[model samples]
Target: MEYDPTLPWYRRLHWQVLSAMILGLGVGWAFGLPAANAIGWIGELFMKLLRMIIVPLVLTSIVSGVASVGGGRAIGRLFGKTMGYYVLSSMLAALTGLLMVNLIRPGQNADMGAAAQQEVPELSTPDSAVDLILDIVPNNFFAAASAGDMLAIIFFCIVFGAAITGLPEKPRVVVTDIFNAFFQAMMALTSGIIKFLPIGVFALITKMVGETGFDRFAALAKYFATIGSGLTIHLFITMPLLLIVLGRIKPLVHFANLREPLLTAFSTSSSGATLPVTIKTLREKVGVSNKVSSFVLPMGATVNMDGTAIFECAGALFIAQVLGVDLTIGQQAIVVLTALLASIGAAAVPSAGVVVIFIVLNAIGLGDNPEAITIVGAMLAIDRPLDMYRTAVNVFSDSCGAAIIARSEGEEGVDTEVRH
Candidate 1:
């Protein structure tokens, strides 16, 4: 296929996203909340459309990727590399956030009294670790699909993929080809839907900015600044350091290659929603092999959440500080471990961070009081912006994981030296 340079800039995905963000901010500021509210349906519709396709896309892509990895041995290697990177990066991110929050103490000056007035929903404590494990298995695929439980979907995909691997050659080839075609069709559909992303993003942002206003921003200024600062440090400093030292890729080139997907993830605030863009950027711009990008990005979207993990850790500490709860060394260790695991367990959905925050609070004994949960609610008022920032980090880490995995797989010819 020949490159088409005559396409209008607005027709391009990234440019559209940029335009939406700019226009959204402008509209929100000018006409205020009511005007922003009028267009809220556009963002709602966009999210619904994305949610509609998520289950099938995740299922088909993961199953096809796993099946293509071939028998038990290849699957083992792929799993090891993929999970290893996820676990390590997620832990590092969690720790990074934890360290920053501890040092800065963003909530130290905040009043918990105002937060106490907000009615906090009573959260049920999960029975045990075993119960959590049991919950991973989907009793009904339809139920899981309806609920958009990504971990459950991932569980199903792995098993289904393995089954595909065991089938006889003729049948396997036919089944694989069918899935491949389905995956492509879904991608095409996603592309068409994303053409409206600018509209959706504009609506979403305008609503957010219009609703919150400058007053709320002033109230949570410190907390937002803390999380934002942490994300910036990780995205610019830590991640790039890893890219250069561990991945052996130039940081600027990797960032340049990742511009499109990073922006998409930032705008969407859902890594799963940004998968198509991530895959395309890795394959086309960064020159990762399809086999690598296809395998890594989907799995990373599920299990590899460096950004969310970081937010969870920082959020936990911020809440703890506001509540005057002093976490011990042992308790901090528990936060690290739980946040890492919780990141893996978190569903790749819009409000998933709230659920994960609840889990983290419960783990650290902060869930006993309704007041603590209310404090989290205060955090939620500013969560959307921070969510976008963290999501960009999430997608960046995923791409880095892909590059590292691709190198290990001997598919490094795509970018021997990452371009600036």
Candidate 2:
């Protein structure tokens, strides 16, 4: 675009982000670590605010969406389609990563000496999968909500929504209208918060860069290259092709509508924080029905982490290789299955990916020692960039899912103009 010099400063998200990033980098480099440390607090504050809203927003939106499904059969179909798409897309993303990493052999020459300086901390092993499933049932809803336990929250929302559906029509209408207003209000609030994203992103990026410097990139070059290359291939090749062939939408137009949210997600690195932008872009710009966008985006943000799932599987394999552990074909299959399940269990909370990785490592029998956890710490050091890529994938996957769902609902032709 065009710049309106007369417009207020906050009216321009791009300008704000660019300015913040440049200024933050200058301050970080010139003033050394102290300035960067102070600025980091601002990013943490922004994430805290967004996270504070996620549970309530997800609960309300999901309950409302499920309640809109008029009957049991309708609800069943929607659930089937939503979950089916998540599984397929996530598995494809994981497999794509595996293929690329193996083809490139990015970790073949990894320097264990460089990784020697890293300190591995002892971590408690994760509970079994059965225990993880059992933990989904909240002993106390208030505690679960307060803790932002996503699976429990989702469980509660579905039950609450189903109950609302079973109510009389007049009462159900009022409840639905009330929730509609609630969701709209939350969206508005989210939009207001997003205006501050550039500041948050700048702080987050500058602090990370200042602490690690550029040398860390060299040390983990192979790992980074592997993940980055996989992400690029998926974004440019797999996703666009899928959109064109399966969704029957123009990929160029679809991407144009997605630009703002995708960029915001890249910069901010929190899919939960990016949810407002994703929903707005999907419904207003890409012509996805509100029914589909509302139902899919929130759930996708929580469960459909295609990028992270791929990274977890690929990263695990890399770790196993570096540790000189040869995994059988059956074990590799287990890795794929466990990564898919772990991605769903992984919440959208801050630094939650680290926990998810730990869970994955434990499942693969690497959790007995500090080596696996140290690998994770190394991954965490470069997580900002990886997070950006993954969030984009997450948003892209959600958009495609929304398009497919819209097509299924016969609302694909609702609008042709790009809404961004």
Candidate 3:
């Protein structure tokens, strides 16, 4: 809510990352492969730092988030409706990305000789739906955590945290506090790592451009277009349809009411930071009651990230396409599921979806590939603006959920309690 408009532009994170990327491009273009090979290690090291934080960060953030959900029939129905909307919306958003990527085929015929350095390696798609299911519930939690298997960790933590909610008050409080503190600690650690994003972006871009000579960047433009189109469909077509059919609210009025929060979300690029404005707009201008707005908006901000979901699914598939790896139907399904789960974990970090795209790539068996990080770093270089757009879609989806749920609950004047 508070911003210092007078601050110098270069002092901002996005601008700094932009400057680094431009510098990387110049150095690589002028000096060529030698420059790329020299600085590539720094970028790889930055990515390694990211992988280092994943296990603890995923474990703590998810469990602590789910632990906040209370148990009882008093709010059970409301909880179910709220969660159903979040889950369904997020799935549709991701599926939109999946559809667009396959149709556009943005990564087709991309020249990666320098980047791939060999024949296109076969994609490591998921074996079967049954195997994927089995993989989700690991035999040993600690073993899964140690192996850095995110799917198993996410499943166990969700179930574990839900069970904690059903526990007696005293024990629940004790356990919840521990995870909460640990989650904060991990976030602080992540914040520190995110600070080096410019360095990482610079190294990755310099290496890729140095080797491949900007051909991939052409594909990157198409890739960016693919994501943008998917997000636009989900934002304009899908969300407005939900508003009309589900909430019975006029899309025009709702958009008008949300003008302030959407702009704030776009500028800040953070749903968490824009929460105060989102809630106030939904409750005051859009005409939802306090009870509905308070409960739904907070949880939605945490777990209901529709825009990020689309980005994750599309990003993983685009990476596969770029490396000429064909993802199987089951593997695509895995991308969808991973995107959903990663959206929940994404809430705790600075560059939420950008960081989690690595997780989606890893789930689809591409994490170990050194080349994957190169493209990811390129994506990071252009991420700030993309992040802004998706984040607005995210906040807008949350408001729509609150409005629809309030209407379904038989609350009068839903989206009509006040007019801006």
Local distance difference test values of all predictions, in order: 0.78, 0.75, 0.75
Better of 2 and 3 by TM-score: 2
Best by lDDT: 1
User: Relative to the unseen true structure, what is the C-alpha lDDT of residue 260 in candidate 1, on a scale of 0 to 100?
Assistant: 72
For residues 112-217, write the lDDT of model 2, one tens digit per residue.
Answer: 4575243334333236778777776889989999976666777777778889999988999999899988988887787788778787878876776666555566
Q: Where does model 3 exceed 4 Å of error?
A: 1-71, 111-219, 348-350
Q: In model 3, how large is the Cα lDDT of residue 233?
A: 97
Candidate 3 lDDT, 102-178, residue by residue in tens: 99987787544433222222323334457667777889999998876556776787678778889999999999999
- Tens-digit per-residue lDDT, 8-98, candidate 1: 7766666777888898888888888897679877887877787778778777777778888888788778878888888888988999889
Clash total of candidate 3: 0
Compute the lDDT for candidate 1. 0.78
Estimated TM-score for each candidate? 0.89, 0.88, 0.60
Tell me the lDDT of model 3 at 255.
78
